[model samples]
Target: MTSFLTISLDFELHWGRFDKTRLRDYLEYYQETLQVVPAILEMFEHYGVHATWATVGSLMADNEEEWRAYMPTVLPQYKYERYSAYRWFDAQPQIWEEALFAPHLVRQLIDCPGQELGSHTFAHFYTCENGGSAKAFRADLKAAKTIAKSKFGQELKSLVFPRNQINEAALAISKEEGFDTVRTNPQDWYWKHTVDENLIKRLFRTGDTLVSLGQKTSYQAPQRNGEELLGLPASRLLRPFRKGSLFNQKRISRIKEEMEAAAKSGEVYHLWWHPHNFGHYPKENLRCLEDILQNFSVLKDTYGMESRSMGEF
Candidate 1:
């Protein structure tokens, strides 16, 4: 059986759209989002699935007082920043919203096993682009880790670069920070020129040959340096995602079939995504998850692949 591994999830909520006005209005839709998070946790608990949440540290700070009421004051610090990947709305609006919502999410993370809280950068900058300057970029990560330690008590280790943007500079800082792994996109040089649907298409890292002339360099797990951070790339999809639902039953069946074949071939198949994706069609996605879980059950029995979070990669 192939020793298979699933990259779990990089769970955060309501990304993709980030306009101030729209963000303010969109906040109304997620009013009940904080409430439904427990159900998502239950799904994983029931399935015996392990996942990693590249936690937004703000999720903890926002709800700090509320959580402290219940948890020890000396909890692990989590990394969440005011202007990080959470760049939406004006600073006040963003801070207010986070203050209202993050505590519950942070508390939810406290006891989850088979999970790792990794750095997703303090500011969700496209370091590869943005001309943000290397010094500025490195400074931002430093601030994020500070927040993570002060707020969550956890040392920032593994990372998932914002949008999987990677380059020599990013590699250097990540290694400096002692991050062991970082997810990277090794598609092509001009692939991300425009942020259209193709933006994701431009993120594929094929055949493990990441450090090609055009592709981002090979990122190893337990990131070492420019070319050493652990690289956990998502496997190929049979087809592009036309719908936003958690993959359907047919896809789950297909994924299971692929895992079976790979186990026979002795290779690692990695699957990953953002958890808030389920929020798009929560009920239907849960159904899809059940299908996927069933297939994983089959895979577990047939192949010896263990579901692993990015920390394990």
Candidate 2:
């Protein structure tokens, strides 16, 4: 059998830093790199590559004026999360100026080919670990689903929880909302690939490297002690580089080596990262992605590996 590859991206917007003080600094970064989205589509189109985009619904919910200014051709309701909005938004509906940017960002992603707008959840609710407001999260998903149906004409299914935070309760809630799969950390929870505790804490992780690639496992249904109510473990790891830049030949080599090995193994390699990172380092990141896809093309020919979407995985 062929080793499968799943390259997924969480497309969300970022207006400022998690810290309010650094808001302007981050907005400038967003302005400089917004063009990366189109560039990303160009590269993928060149490589015959497809990816899953865990989307943000709030982008469509953005105020309307900004949409006409920044992304004229793109539809706003179809995309969200790629642009972070702490600075773009204001307490009393502050900076209503930036709100228009949201819809355009959504439009670009929704119309992009081979990019599935998977849910990143409204406001990236970190439910499992830091339960700031689970109830609010529930409301966000409902709103997100509504926008998806009305704006994109698509039904939402898979979810990439904010912070990769999940548990049985989260999954139960997700399933109730018609979500079949919720991403989780693969460890003592479910489909643990290896036995080494430390090594497993780095490679096979989401948001952050919780562990390393310890072992590989098959796709199984949820069990009593499963990791998530519905589990989808991200199985591949990049070189842990920042999203914006091409680090060096060494880093690229290391990532390709790991991908090459997975291609030979017949196991599923699910890869993910944030879209705004592409905006941050558009040129360098595109080069890095180009190299990654080159390796993927090689494996596709040599091992007959196929690409899959998050729903299929």
Candidate 3:
């Protein structure tokens, strides 16, 4: 059996960080995502890397009107309304920034060979937030499917929950909604899926990026026990490469070590990150990605480790 390496991206533009991020502050970073996407695709093709772009469905629309028209009927009523993308979008009907809409970028991903376009959710739905309901999740899934089919002719088969908030109630709905695979967080206790952020978990997770302070960051193959949906748990998050940071080498080395261990043991290694992670340092991030992929090429020849999209499992 070959060791499998999977890459999934949380490809939400403003929708991913709207609650806390002000577009005015990070406009340049957001704009960089559009510029870096083509370069990222170019690198993937060159390195024979296969990835899943688990995107925000609103990104498929050309404008805010089309996006609003596809809003889920049962919207989430989070205690903090700011968490609701629909509420945020409703407040600002006219989108002044192009950073929020990226139909062209989504189209490029769809047209790219060996790339899978999956759903992050219709509006970056928070499945684990307070007052969230199964009805809302199901409705969100339906809206995502509807827009994706209409825009890109894609039947989305993979899902990466917003904020990695895996809602157990929504698993069956995901299968019924035609999703075959879903990315779960790592098995580590600190990596447990949750809407509420924990300070201890954050400290451990942040420290682990530079050193072996937590889980080994490797997992077995995705489990599909007589079910329509397969559990494609992530092994590690590819921390954004920060230029001029002394910790950059250590972080990259840790990731490489985990990848090597997975390759040698024939385990599964799933690496994920957001496209905006590369927004600030596009060139450096691309170089870091190329280095990782180049190492993967070596692992491929030596151990038959294969690069796969999330749906492949």
State every prediction's TM-score relative to the real structure.
Answer: 0.72, 0.73, 0.96
Q: List all candidate RMSDs to the true structure.
A: 7.5, 7.6, 1.4
Global lDDT scores for all candidate models: 0.54, 0.58, 0.87
Question: Per-residue lDDT tens digits of candidate 3, residues 175-208?
Answer: 8888899998776778886666789989988888
Candidate 1's C-alpha runs over 4 A off are 14-16, 19-21, 63-101, 186-227, 236-249
Tell me the tens digit of each residue's lDDT in model 1 across 116-210. Answer: 67766554455655445677667656765776677667787778765656677778888887787765543454434322336334444321222
For model 1, give the RMSD to the true fold: 7.5
> Would you give me the overall lDDT of model 1?
0.54
| Colliding residue pairs in candidate 3 | none
Measured with C-alpha atoms, the lDDT of residue 63 in candidate 1 is 50
lDDT of 3: 0.87
Highest TM-score among the candidates is held by which one?
Answer: 3
lDDT of 3 at 1: 63
Residue 135: error of model 3 in Å?
Answer: 1.1
